[model samples]
Target: MAFTFQINNELQFNHDEELLKKAEECCPEIKKETKKALHLVKLIQDQTQLDGIGTSILEKDIDQLSDYHLKRDDSLILDFGNHYVGSFSVDLDQVGSPMDAPLYIRLKFAEMPCELNAESQDYDGWLSRSWIQEEFIHIDELPYTLKLPRRYSFRYVEIKVIDTSPKWQVVIKNPTLITETSADYSRLEPLSLEDKTLQKIYDVGLKTLADCMQDVFEDGPKRDRRLWLGDLRLQALANYSTFDQCELVKRCLYLFAGMTAENNKISANVFVKPKPLPDDTFLYEYSLFFISTLYDYNKAHPDLAFVKELYPIAKKQMDVTLKMFTEEGKFIPDEDYPVFVDWSNAFNKDTAGHAETIYVLKQFISLSHLVEDEDEHIYTKALNQLSNYAKEHLFNKEKHLFVTGENEYNIASQVWMVLAHVMDDETNKKIMNNTIEQLFPIKNIATPYMYHHIVEALFEAHLDKEAIALMKKYWGKMIELGADTFWEAFDPDRVSYSPYGSPIVNSYCHAWSCTPVYLIKKYILNSK
Candidate 1:
């Protein structure tokens, strides 16, 4: 369509979408000197020459502003040495998100070639979607310097910018305050006070739950966004007695089914982004391998066709995982030596050495038999070897706990000990009871993440009532705090705490914590 539109609703101008689009594409390309710079794909043009605003002469220099002191309402009238650079205002309030406050800049470009580089001392806001610099940028044509001075919403939005290109045009967007008048979760179906209490318990338990599996879900690759496959299974497990429990399980089974292989090899990590460090662990490989077994149990009994469809991927990852272990009966951490396992790679042959490796090996061994349709020799042999290794190196028989040699021995190793005994009822019981006794005396037994492990051990032992009580107690606290999703740690006080100080990074809307819901539903109430 030939361009015909009113500028500012009064100044008439011909509008051609086709010409503008073509020009927009071409302008940014000319300015981009390298492939990386082309990421922004900016275009520039000298529209003043074409528009004939040759007489709009208006330049107002107040010289009252100091560096980094641009006011939110401030406007710089640029005289095109002709007609005034179309009057542009600071619209800092345009971005939406609670975290973005204090200051931001939005510009209305006057169809001209323009480049802006702020001074080094200019304070840059944190760039996540939640809290800080959340402004949206738009430019229409080439040589389009913004139409107004970079007026920021902040009282001191330090822009130590050194760029002086004969001062083009830019307009800073104003800050808009947003008031959330409605209560949280107001749109959802109203639950009775009792159901509301149950929801609170679920929320609280889930936050702690997320903290428990923090290492597994957040430590993987960009492509592995679905690490919550296990958590989904956990959610199904947690809601067993509720009316929605079955549906939850069905959805979980479908998601887990998607995660599995036809041959039954589960990918250990749903998300496994790699990094350079002392350790090179393939943590996801076996974690998913273990999770697949639980998923298989859900898949087999329900006969959910979606779950049946997921079995192959589980089989494939399983096969690939087992193959990683050597014929000499060693689970080589990876191709690399001196390997250390982090959250995703739970086993490392070098740093964790035999003890840690054996812990993960047992999970794989037990899962092997539980999931296998035929002979269990492969797993049995692996278990026997790991048992022998643990007896020889890892066990501190006197303390009745597995020690990390000398590395600040803690409860983590103890939890893994009980987990190792998953295949042996006697061994599991011993570790479970002893660990509980040890952890009982600690202050705040309600700490969600640690409590999750305790609940997991008890669940494994069929101590449903006890686990449910603890879940209820902990969840009650989380509900009072108004958590829409979950946290990286279980805040019994429901306090607003940051997980960034610790090892955890991703905070809101996690995947691993979803397991508590699964645990409560499946094992406690036996919903399936």
Candidate 2:
């Protein structure tokens, strides 16, 4: 399914207060750091940047921020010189005359320069406009320190004087951002990668993960500031590789375990504010990922007691998902519980879903071994049945690729199948080779999540050179495009592509895009 807004308000959820208390207990005390504006800037046209917009440094120094008071329709951009997620505060006063009327000011926080150039009114996307990081405020008194209540993810802050009485101008001073995250920098292990580009990618990925680390691992701190199961799976992997924050992973697992649908299926995402409520939307792969996440966690930390406590919840998710399988071991997709193989619905996901089932089942079986569950044989049987079905029906030996609904050959199918390892290693390598020849420059796949899978599949298939080339090409392009952190949606063929229809609402530092840290650590550095 496409990455768009999904609302299912009618679905019922049970919130276990006791488990929620555990979630709260595991919540990390967010670390904060104060940052000051680095320079005064103005938007200029540059075709290289997003939206054909760039910034030019103004002649004024940041020290003179309060010298030039802003009148009606006056504005200036403050460059923080880096990306940050935090609350913004600035001191304001009146100049040239006594305070006459309330100083009407508008502030726009942007992670990039293009957002400042795009007017919010011009946005007509289906995503909520409330996510636009612009605020209109009126200060009735002089010498007011305006601190925004809502948290924002941005690098550039645009200050516009919507209206300040004709007699006086508003003086701005000490514009600061109090950045927040749950990451402890000191705990991070240093890396010494010889490849400069790979090192850059790894560092950016770590920052993206660290920024998304909050009360819960948020999918994107910009708009959908909530815990998504798919994002949680990837974030947990990156966390284990870098910060090694096991408690945060435990907290997230308990949060999802504490609340689930009446049918025992975990929600695709959860909300921590106003109360811990599970979203009505459910994705088959995301629910199954709970099993993989727990598996990865225990493999990393090996806590049998924790796994035993949460094993039943993970097993319930597997049972609920397994019921969707047909008698022939094919995954029958349900409209209520869709499988998210990728953002594009252009390709039928049955084959990919089938492969994901196998992937998670393998992990779940490992978890069963940890808990010493007696029913491990049941999962093994299902896994074999699914693998046999894939090889007999889905695999096209002649084409060296797997086929999905309507006998279509797509990259997602091959990548997922290779990841599932339904075929032998040499055959998997040949399938990926064919996939590279057919789908080298991937098109219409806009998510880094899917790209991560593609790269991982390449690594799994022993196509190390091809994997590194794709990584440098796809992620290096983001670096060339001036990304401080990776974006939520990026298509190398289409520089300005947005799944949300407007780049204004796209998250620049998304959680899923941070998998390079995990990939490099697990496959590259650790392999050595």
Candidate 3:
């Protein structure tokens, strides 16, 4: 499922006060820091940069920001030197004559220069234009500080003079952004890597994770500012590797556990604003990821008491998902509860869905052992059945890759099969090598989320060189394209592709794309 638009408002939910209280107790205190614009910049056409848009320095010091009086149709771009998620404020005053007409200005917050170059009026994407991060304001007084009330995620702030009186111009100064996040950078231990590129990748990943860590692990601080199950799974893994903030993970777990559907199924994501409420959207693999997340957390932190508290809820998720399988152990994907192996639905997901069942079932069984559940054998039997079915029906002997519905062989099926360990290590390596030979220079798939799985599967298969190569090729390309932080979607073949049809709405710093830290630490640095 692409996750474009989904609404299931008819579903009933249970808000358990006990779990909600635990969630509140674990809520993190957001850290705040003030950052000033580093330089004045203007957008210029450059085919090398993202969307063929690059920035040029204005050669003016940030201290002299107030000297440049802006009249009608004038504009200035403030470069913060790096990406950040926060609120912005600036001091403004009149320059010449008395304030006659109201100063109508438009402020645009952009994560990249291309976003500043793109016009919101030209945006015809299906996503809500309200998420454009551009605000229009009219100031009637002079020497007043215009502090925006909403939080934004960006690295560039473009102030455009929509209209100003011919008698007077506007003077702007002391533009400040209050950066916000719940991540404690002081706790980050310095890691020295001989490989500079890997170090850079790790650092970027850490920043991406830190920015997304607010009261909860948001998918993106910009758009979809909420906790998603699939994104949470990857974010928690990266959190364990880098920040290791177990309390935030615990808080997120309780939020999910507190508000499941009436049928005990977990929602795809949850909203934290008005209150802790689960979204109506649901994904089969995402719901199963709840089990995988709990398993990974218990492994990282070893909280037996906490595991016991959430084990039953996790088990219920497993039970409901397991019901989607047939007696032959083949997963029948429900359109109502889709399997989100990747955003592209062009490929069949049956093989990926079956492999995902095997993946989460293995983790669930490990949790069952922690709680010493009596029904462990039932899960074990299901795992065996699913694995056996995959090995027998999905694996193509000649192609040396997994096949999905109607013998459709794609990268996702192969990647998920390797990750699930549907076959032995030697065979898994062969499958991955075959996938590279057949599916090299991947096409149509544009998400870092899917790319993360492919890279991790390479590591799991002991194809370290291949794994590092793919990471550098995919993530390094983002850095080359001038990304201070990673993006939600990027297709090397097509740099301008957006699931939302326009880059204006795409999340530049998504949580799922922050897995390089986890990968480098676990695979390259070999850190615990």
Instruction: Name the candidate that leads on TM-score.
Output: 3
lDDT of 3 at 201: 83
| Candidate scoring better on lDDT of 2 and 3 | 3
In lDDT terms, how accurate is model 2? 0.89
lDDT of each: 0.36, 0.89, 0.91
Angstrom error of the Cα, residue 217, model 3: value is 0.4
* lDDT per residue (tens digit) for residues 414-528 in model 2: 9999999999999999999999999777987988999999999999999988998899998888887878888888888888888777778989999999999998988888777
Model 1, residue 362: displacement in angstroms? 8.2
TM-scores, in order shown?
A: 0.46, 0.98, 0.98
RMSD (Cα, Å) for all candidates, in order, is 19.0, 1.3, 1.2
Off by over 4 Å in 1: 1-133, 137-199, 203-287, 290-301, 304-316, 319-375, 391-393, 405-408, 420-430, 436-451, 461-482, 489-506, 522-528
Candidate 1 lDDT, 182-261, residue by residue in tens: 11122223333344565565554443332222112231111122344334434333333222224323333333333333
* Rank list by lDDT: 3, 2, 1
Better of 1 and 3 by lDDT: 3
